[model samples]
Target chain A: MSTITLIGAGQMASALTFPLYENGHEVRLVGSPLDDQVIDRLREDNYHVNLLRTLHDGIHYYKESEKEAAIQGADLIVCGVSSFGVDWFADKILPILDESVPVISVTKGMLDYEDGTMQTYPEYWMSKLPEGSKQEIYAIGGPCTARDLADHDPSFVGYCGPKMETLHWIRSLFATDYYVISLTLDVVGLECAVALKNGYALGTALAIGMAEKAGDDGINHNNSEAALFQESVKEMLDLLKIVGGGVDNIMYAAGDLNVTVAAGRSRTVGLLLGKGLSIDEVMEQLKGQTLEAVVIATRTARAVKALAKAGKVKESDFPLLMHVNALLNEGATLNIPWTDFQKEM
Target chain B: MSTITLIGAGQMASALTFPLYENGHEVRLVGSPLDDQVIDRLREDNYHVNLLRTLHDGIHYYKESEKEAAIQGADLIVCGVSSFGVDWFADKILPILDESVPVISVTKGMLDYEDGTMQTYPEYWMSKLPEGSKQEIYAIGGPCTARDLADHDPSFVGYCGPKMETLHWIRSLFATDYYVISLTLDVVGLECAVALKNGYALGTALAIGMAEKAGDDGINHNNSEAALFQESVKEMLDLLKIVGGGVDNIMYAAGDLNVTVAAGRSRTVGLLLGKGLSIDEVMEQLKGQTLEAVVIATRTARAVKALAKAGKVKESDFPLLMHVNALLNEGATLNIPWTDFQKEM
Candidate 1:
């Protein structure tokens, strides 16, 4: 029975709060400038964030203003807010928190609002904290989805921190038979991993939609659709390297787990777009787009740009990353031709 | 029941034969020299092709030498041989046959060994006949694999002919509950459709492998692997367009079906390679490797070059095709950076 404080009432915040509560942990949920309806809904639903029809329990909801007070005695502080809210929460909550409280990030990516890998979301947030603050931040990622988890779908999620103990603690905090969790101490590796996965997810959705429209009336392969999917995986894996992920990690992404993951928010969002729904109107249709992978890809693309500029990343990965970034932001309409990349490959 | 004669007894031949047999059609099987053992095994086992405990019945197996006599009265003569054997069989068999015979080509591509297409395959094969002789050739394709069909794994298979009656006849003859067969008279479109699917598949395997090998650390997403897969799909769609595949087809290739399909094959091959197996060893280990997309990518690269020289394919597609060709033959290495691309997005 650990007390967990989650800062944010956004889609991700609700997602984390409900699950932690259901797992028998006491959770304090906080959101920035949080609306009364969201708070009312959280309280009425018992911290339940319903998606595909499952309810999660045990959350004590609060506004962001109450975070410091609410988190005072908490064993763990998790930030499940969007990338923009990291600084606001860190500034207000860190000063009042106990020094030893382990913090876990249920969010999927680094903030993309700036330049340099040093400017990534968590790194930027941690930089403002006291010197030893880096050890407190950890990230949880992988194929798990908010909608699915909200629906109580049996799923796999991964958490990575600098220390094995921190990771283990997080695993224990989030673990359940229905929600299988794994731990790793590769903090630097994990942040980008989730981000890349998100980007790939969004990009894949676009690519698949495009291929379905194209069919098998091409000059080369009999079914260009099959060729497109096959090649899309390969392209995603390559971009993974440029962004600082390992090949083994991509094996999982390009593997069934990530591929099988339902992109609920992205799918709905894309479908709305396909059906001629404007983004703003579609944004009003339901909750915000919580596909962390897309957000992460955008952020990591910035980080990779910083890495490349600093001479940390190789020059060769430039064009590939450029193509991916374009797709992540504008959708997958601008992938480079492999034939254009023979020498590089 | 319609009498169907299947030519060639390799993996594809065996795969194509079972579905027809399972549909309760009486199939007369003919094999190349290399397929003697395959024929004997099917005969000894009472004509069964087993894939992971799913058994399919195989009926009437024979050697290529016996095809002439066996196929004499067959209503539909379907050939599933490698692109290499089209000429040999056409010359030997088409001559002795009646002009009214309808032939269905299960091969998605032309034999580079002899120039062929929906136009050329029939034109060349029928040209040798007496001046007044006439024969109809139909081409069929879809995403279905024989191995999957043998195991009764439900999937879509398609057939196309020059005439509606011919297509309807083929579809009716081949359709079954387990196999969903669609018929079309867009023979030219169908020929290229199946052929282009290979490019997307091969490009996917190559790109994902590279990304995974380069930097996607056991994390699946925004890292290098996702980027690469994303990029590869974009590139494939671009190339598909340049090479004559419709833009609409790109979505299907990028979709879940294509992603799942490629992920399975790429992971299998990649895992084998990662486990220190040679490419040939990996190829040998999987029976489905025969239809492996890379073979078609390479073949298309060859065809692109040929078409470029003859001014048949688009000029823009030529350069990209040339580049892919180089990559396939050279086995080049890629070390792309993510930083530059992030800025572009």
Candidate 2:
């Protein structure tokens, strides 16, 4: 059995070990320096507190200090760290990784380059690797939640990168009957779509919140949500196209984003905001919570606005994105100018 | 004030009178031949028993026998009849309708032409009207529920027709601050999108039903629903393109369809079918209730299958459509072949 090194002990990383372990792979789950306590818990109990279950016996735990030992002879390396940690992980692991070993990223976010161009997580990671490195890099995205993956509920995800030939082996390494993986070479589209979803989810959550506050008894806000969903998708597709990604990737992006919003967090934040709570009040309500939507919304909006200023993207092309960005970053109100929305994308 | 004649006494028609009456238009809500009892109720109580609320006092009710008088001097005529009644209404009213009076259809469905062509309701109505009649036909579509409209909840709908100039007056005539309207020239796409939504809603309903039966407690089936939704939109876009409509129209179609599925009827039928009730059992359970999704799913599937045979459309292009059709017409089990779904679409 091949040994797979997963460099992160977060929820996604923990959830991912199930599929690899179930596929008869030896899993080395190395926790970040910040995850020493989690590593201790895993070593003692073989359980992930976040997942609320004991991991399979096939898993081996490693602390951040054991990085080189964990990566030295692994068949494949996977990075499941949060987007913010990609650069740090790259700096730590790239020098030690074998040039022959391929890397697959489960991280979804955008990176702003020094040149002011926005790069996806996979792109950013690949750029940080040693020059002339033959190792292929791929990104995984779609509606597969960490909890659902852990539960062995049927999950579908997209594997995307420039190296199409490498995906079959990657697919075989992780895919179970319940964990289905579809392949695409549209890496830019897939990564951008995944990163931008959190921002869009915030917009939809606001609509949900407004519907709840409107107090139409027994009438669900599905209509408003659907409208917001369509608009969000349109804006996403437009932004993707502007950033040199395929519009076709919208299918996967829309599906994944919809699922994410429906399952809470982003929507929960939006619901509170939509109920007429100010940003400060909502943040107080969600005190001590790491709201990914807020983080991504602020960052992606900044990146897009920068792109717009450089004439690489048009501001008018993305009214919803601008409104959402303003709402999150500039303390703008939750009033979405639905009338100014373009009918065609 | 402009005199407007709405020639259907159904829920949508009844709901629509609120806007017209509120806008100070002289509204003549004429019942079809089948709506004798509804007309009697409206005349007696000025309330739609189905809506559980009284209509504004300004509306003028007309019996089925008063069709000629209702249409004689109307500034505009709107048909809110169900799909099944479109042909019957066209036969009755086409001869009496003035050539100068524009018609707006709130009916959403398709008609099978004798030559094996499928025409949207607006097209079917326009085709049946007197040649050289010069009457502009438009369609109103979106996530507008009759109950919501009657309750004066904020609603947004699209007005689509070839006559761009006519939309201004149409918008002004119907749009309240709460009842918003957008305009498009893609009448074919709008009508087809609205009609086909029922069929797609059935597919999504089945997904929801299956998710509910799978019993993954606390895990919202939003992922499954989202996947199904994306597939539905792809099939819709493909079909719309094949039928000489814009794929851009997918925005409105997706929004309307999502809203429709989430808020009952179609989903109810799907849920029951998903719960292992045979088609016959579900029908028996509903008794004499009119299930629009069931009617549309059977018809749309038949139409698509016929198109597939004629090389007009590819059967492989629409797996969800084919599967739903099989489930409804062939008594097939609720087996969704998710793996076989096209990744790009």
Candidate 3:
């Protein structure tokens, strides 16, 4: 069995850990060195998935200092840490990882640095890797949520990276009856897919809630949704392309994720909005929870706006994107009222 | 039991028949003199929805001549006929029915001859009535589809007219455990809601399908749907105001008819599209099925376009509305790839 060491025990890390364990890997999970509650849960669940499936006896958990020893002889080093924690891990963990060992990142979004040139976790990690070790860092992406898989309905999605072998290794490690079809290779494409998909899914959730409140018959009319879907996909694809990703990113982003309707975290926010719950109430609920699609969409809008202002992207894409951001963050009030708008519809 | 004569056995007629009969109304189902399976089924069932629910012994069926006689002393003349047939009925049936018989129409869209006026079936019927008989016609609208009611899940919508008594009668005859909440009055407002909601639903469906195809997650990005939903509702409401409809029409259209994300037929089409069914295939399956929202959206787009061309509406609203029509018809395929355009999603 391949020895697998994963950094971060947040949502994505939790989501990734189960698949790796299921595929018969000797897995080691490490969360924040700071949060006692997070580390405690990781320590408890490190041996198994609680309330869902059986746990692997070979699985282990570690503190940050113990992470180096955990990965000392590992075949794979997978990082599912947040964007904010990448620098900390890069400095602390990279030094201990073997020079030949490959690292795969499940994190999306840019580092909130002034330059914004550094877009993803893999990019940041690759930069820190010793000179010729550039090809060792890969980005893993697709439509995946830990809650959905834990519930056991079959869900299919795509995953890609620049290295075909690394992609295949990751795909082979996660492919199962519950989670199927992970494509190997195309890092930029898959990265764009996951990043943009998160935003779009949140948007759909927000709209569904608004449509419900406005009493819209939730049916497709005049191809209204089709246009929005297409235009939004295109805009995200174009923006990603301009930002150094490929057009294929659009395909993975649009098709692979089975989250056409919102569920879990996004749905919770949407339902709260439907009940007229304010953003403050939502924030309160979200405290200490891993950042969700709603949070991601807001971050994306800010990132895109910055990109547009830097003259790296088209100015026209901002308004719609901004409006979408407002819909998710500020709630339906930021959107046009149902009755006032339905007249035009 | 009060005698209720319904003229039409189309989708809407078939849908409404069950509830009226179940509520203990002596419903006389009437249709055009044609040899059709649905008509045959209605006759055999005695206009009963027994196959759908429990058999209703109170319901009856009749020919056109029998309908005229049935309506002579009927408590209500409820028409669920097609838009094209409304005039024919107005010419033939209205003359024979007693002037005191109040009518409620479920048909939407304007009469072909009265293209300039945004008149619905009730309005067309009123115009043909003798002096002071205008008050006899009313309408029930918003997104209560026949399929939903036939499935037995409760569907709530709105009923409106100029008279409070007429609105009350419409609500009393229609409302049931399976059907609830018919917000009272304002015929003009009801018509505006009906027309606009249908058009916008179609637009929303197409956009959802397009986004799925374009490889973008349809979740929360841009809440593009919020824009479509809000803008389309506004357009419909404003048009109603500009052309003269009750303020209540906007509320009903924008509030009561909103389809649940799971319940919307158009969303089903989009989901099928995501599952790799072509639009043509979808249309074929939907052949002979009544998709009122889709039909009305198309009709609404045509009406809006014509109004725009005639300089009766503002040019500013043309892009989104016109684009909605184009997407519904064949989608914006100009320079887009066939795979991108024709992707089952």
Scored by DockQ, the top model is 2
lDDT of 3 by residue, B1-345 (tens): 688888876666766777787887787777655414445666675443422432345556666655656676788888777765766778777788777778778887553222445656667677777887644777777655565565444444556666776666666776666565445556666676666666555544443554455564323322233323434444665667766775434434543223522245555554444344555676787786555555565666667666766888754553445554554576543121111111101
Query: What C-alpha lDDT does candidate 2 achieve relative to the native structure?
Result: 0.78
Interface RMSD of each: 14.2, 2.9, 14.3
* Tens-digit per-residue lDDT, A50-105, candidate 1: 33232355567786666667787899888776665666767776667676887777
For model 2 chain A, the run of ten residues with the poorest summed lDDT: A336-345
Best by lDDT: 2
Candidate 3: segments with Cα more than 4 A from true spot: A34-54, A111-118, A211-234, A255-261, A270-278, A292-295, A310-314, A326-333, A336-345, B1-261, B264-345
True contacts kept of 2: 0.25
Report the candidate with higher TM-score, 2 versus 3.
Answer: 2
Q: What is the TM-score of chain B alone in each candidate?
A: 0.73, 0.95, 0.77
Docking class for candidate 1? incorrect
Misplaced by over 4 Å in model 2 are: A112-117, A215-219, A303-317, A342-345, B112-117, B214-219, B310-314, B342-345
Count of backbone collisions within predicted model 1: 93
Candidate 2 lDDT by residue in tens digits, A236-292: 777777678876677666767767777757878878877878778988999976687
Ranking by DockQ: 2, 1, 3
